[model samples]
Target chain A: MVWLLVLIPLLLAVAAVLIPSGRLRPWLVPFGGLIQVVLVVFAISSENVSGFQGWLLLDPLGKLVLLFISVLFFICSLYVPGYLSLRAERPTRLFCACLLSMLGMMTLMTLSHHLGLMWVAMEATTLASAPLLLFNSSTRSLEATWKYLLIGSVGIALALLGSFFLAYASLYEGLESTLQFDDLIKLAPHLSKPWLHAAFVLLLVGYGTKMGLAPMHTWKPDAYGEAPGLVGALLAGGVTSCAFLAILRFYSLCVASGEAAFAREIFIFSGILSMVVAAVFMIRQRDFKRMLAYSSVEHMGILVLGIGVGGLATYGALLHLLTNGLTKGVLFLSAGNIHRAFGSKLTDDVRGAIRRVPMSGALFLAGFLAITGSPPFGPFISEFTILNGAIGSGKFVVAALFLLLLAIVFVGMGSTVLRVTQGTPSTPATATDFRESPRFVIPILLFLGMSLLLGLYIPPQLESLLKNAALFVENGV
Target chain B: MYQLIDPILVAVLLLNFAALGASQLRTVIHAIALQGVLLGVLVVVAHNEFTIWAVLMACAAITLKGIFIPRLLFHAIREVSIRREVEPIIGFIASLLLGGLGTALAVLFSNTLPIAQEHVGSLIVPAALSTTLTGFLILTTRVKAITQVVGYLVLENGIFIFGMLLVEAMPFLVEIGVLLDLFVAIFVMGIIINRISREFSTVSTRNLSSLKE
Candidate 1:
């Protein structure tokens, strides 16, 4: 059953490539996405689903991430036919194939219980997502794709070394070395402390690079800015969530080994550093898409900060994982529509977006509010939960810093969002014929609605799942 | 293990320095390819006993890293019609000096990490670290897109050298997956390099600077 989740998407990808018509290829995405959501629903409800000799399994943590990715991908998939139709001049074969393969790889990454298999899956996701970044085929998009491939590959390579270090940590203790997550956790306490520490640093930098954490986050802005909005949404929402899940897996190993304190300090430092970096860049940003990238960096920081604070914060981080992902879906898709409607993504030329495209414009403004931690939006609840956890854990300075950064990001991002959404068009007519359509508008609306609902209420099943995931990370269930 | 592995590891380390000091992209690419071949040999010799798995991995590593990827890069450079000589942000002399310093640092760093009893006295860990550091140096310092890819290869080689310490621990499927990913990554990079040259009229990353904050 678990294998089917991975196999189905891959097969769909093959089907996408084999089918010739550009018009038909786009529909396969939503079909694959729908299948993914259904499979995830079943997988989550079942007990102890394992695949490939138990190299892949859905734990509580995996389930949360898998569910978020499925739902996000499905929503974004709904926007694909509309998006491809708008860009009918460009080829859809590569775009369709890469998107589906990326979904397959993200699923594999989430389900991977073995660290090596997980690394392979993670690297595959980078490869799979690279071509999607190149969909625009412009010089800038080319540059973005180049940087993404290089930086992502190098980061993932370091992650491989880190995985080796982890395996060696066990070997150094004279134990039969294995990268099975369960075995690593069981052997956690006895593993060599120095190697374990080194492995964590390497893995942190490695996976952190993937998650667009600061310093290594140099690739995020360019990739997100140049990639199509749908790709940006998936990259920000689906791919980063998988990487965050990878980090959580390791964080769990550290907890099992009683090194959570050591790990938490680094997480606190990195989490704060990422947020500060994102906040600094978000201020007066010209490119709305790039601004969204910075916002992603900031949110990634918050997620890690929540985890760093631990206890209730871990739960907050887990919940933020889902909220931030869905909210990004809304932000990027609507922003994409604005870019298309105006034939520009820069504020100088993209004014009066609301006048240009009413539905997406309002959705864009609403997404900005939701993402900036405004009440009645998902991020507010999750961000507040994290702050509460920080304060509850007695980290007053971190709590203060968290609030300060969020406020800064809100103001900085708000100015950009408002400028794009509120003003009159600089020119009455733009180059693109793009306008508000149900296919494009509805997905963003759906994502935004989910974000709002999450903010207002937590379904009982989701609440329990979040609690189990939080506990799983803290105590290594 | 030490007698056979040490020489190959040492050659691999020297190639790291060669790649750092070399100005010609062709020389750098060859240095990387040679290092790949050497690491391929290291995979076989690092083990105490010969096994079919080691041979298969070595073949895949050599064919992909040594033969196939270099050919692809060579084709890219030719098609892009770029200069063979690469301009480094850091001078050759400085990069060579840094490479030497890195080798020393790597040795010191390896001494800090506890080695297993069976792997005692092997040069694999230090060699891996220095090669990785050298790759980072070249990757960061070089201006040309092709040279940067070469740097990434060096970086991956360093990690592969480190992998030799626990060869048996890595499953065959994962090993193949890693190689397949490296192949596909370079392949995609090759296409992007061509596109970059076509769009910007140069393979140097200097032309890729428009998207900065």
Candidate 2:
């Protein structure tokens, strides 16, 4: 089943290249996505406990991450066909192949237990996603692609250094040097404190770059802004989550070594800093896509903060991962529709999305509400849990500040979203442009429905998965 | 022979100095290529191994670093028709002095690390890190995309040197993967640089700064 999760996408990527018809290629996306999701279901149901040593693994955390990636990819895949169809001049074949390849690399990243293997997969994700960012091939897209490549490459390089430090930490402990997660965990207690400390910091900064956590988040806005809507959705909702999981894996090692407090401090500092950065940027954000990018940085902050707060907050953080992923999917896809509708992402230019395309506008508005942590939304529940955990942990000041930041972000994002969704259509609506095909609308609706359902009820199985994932983080391997 | 290699490390350091000092684009690329060749030779000497695979990898590194990259860059420079890196955001002497300070700081920081290995002292990691920092500094301070790519290559060389300290533990496959990725990355970046030069009439990142807030 684990093999199937990776295999289906790999196969689809090949088929996308082998099959020459551009029209036939777009279908490959949703088809591959759905098949991967089905395989994920099978893997989850079978409860496969075996891990392919020195390479892939299906631990509890991996399972949860795999599920998230699958679900997000499934949603984004539904949107891709319509997106590619609309951009009729561009070749869809490379786009489909790259997207599926990205999915495969991310799947591999989630399942990877060896640090070296994980690094390779993460690097592969960066390589695969660069072309996706360059889908439009404009000067702006080129700049974004360059920034993404350079920053991601640097980050991965630092991660490799950190992995070396981790291996060195084992040597310091008089244990056989290894980069396997299980082996590292087994040797955790004997590891040198200083090397472990350095390793954790390096890993956080490196992975944090990908997670878009504050100071290291310079590339997110540009890349997300330049990439197509579906591409943005996959990156924000899928790639970042996989990166977060990678951080959690290392955090688990720190916890086992009883050095978690040190790691938590770093997470808290970076997370809060990210929140402040996002809040400041969100205020004056004119471009809707860029605004979504900042929102992603903010949520990443919240996710890290949740983990930093610890205990039940870790559960909240894990849940926030799911919530943030789903909300971002809804927001980016719908925002894409709005961008397509107005032919601009500038909030000043895009007015009355509701009046323009009623379904997309409503979904956009709802996504805004959902993302801002309004009641009866997935993010709301998750944010509240985080606050509860913070307060329970006696971090009252942190909780207060967290709430304040959330409020500011809410106002900032809400004004932008509301401005786009509620105003009268400034442009005279052409009959041909106002109507988005069902292909695009269905994915937005699907993601919005999932998020709304999550708000209403937490399924027992998913609840268990989240709980187990949290435990895995708290207990290590 | 090991003691003789110390001056080569100094030569590597001087190459960075030369990079900082050189105003002409051609000189900078030449200095970087020299630094690459020096590092490649250093790798062979330091390892004291003549294994075919390791030697081939070393030669490939030298070729990519000293020859292929510089050649591609010269072509880019010709195509862009830019003569010098004008208005480098920092003056040459000051940047060189800062590079020195950065190198000094790297040594200071490396001393604080609790490295138990006695075979190699703190100098290698610190030198590599300082060079990496200087490369980053060049990348940010310089406006020209070609110079930035040169900076990136220098940065990768720094990382490669640092990786040498861990070569025993780091698998060959991972090393190969890193090199391949780096090659492709530069190739793609070179293509982007060409496109940027054509569209914007300049490869300065400032010209591409239209998408900001």
Q: What is the lDDT of candidate 2?
A: 0.83
Evaluated on chain B only, candidate 1 has a TM-score of 0.93
lDDT string for model 2 (A53-95, tens) is 5467788888888999999998888877777777879867778
Per-residue lDDT of B1-213 in model 1, one digit per residue for the tens? Answer: 558999898888888888888888889889888987888888888777888988988888888888878888887878888888989998999999999999999999999999988788989889989989998998899988778888888888888888888876655433733453464445435564557767877778899899998
The list of candidate 2 runs beyond 4 A from truth reads A49-52, A172-174, A431-434, B1-5, B48-50, B120-122, B173-177, B180-184, B187-190
Residue-level lDDT of model 1, residues A276-382, one tens digit each, is 99999999999999999999999999888889999888888898998999999999999999898888899998888888899999999999999999999888999
Q: After aligning candidate 2 to the native by TM-score, how far in Å is the CA of B157 from where it should be?
A: 1.6
Error of 2 at B3 (Å): 3.9
Model 1: residue A99 alpha-carbon error in angstroms: 1.4
Q: How large is the C-alpha RMSD of every model relative to the true structure?
A: 1.5, 2.0
Best by DockQ: 1
Cα displacement (Å) at residue A154, model 1: 0.3
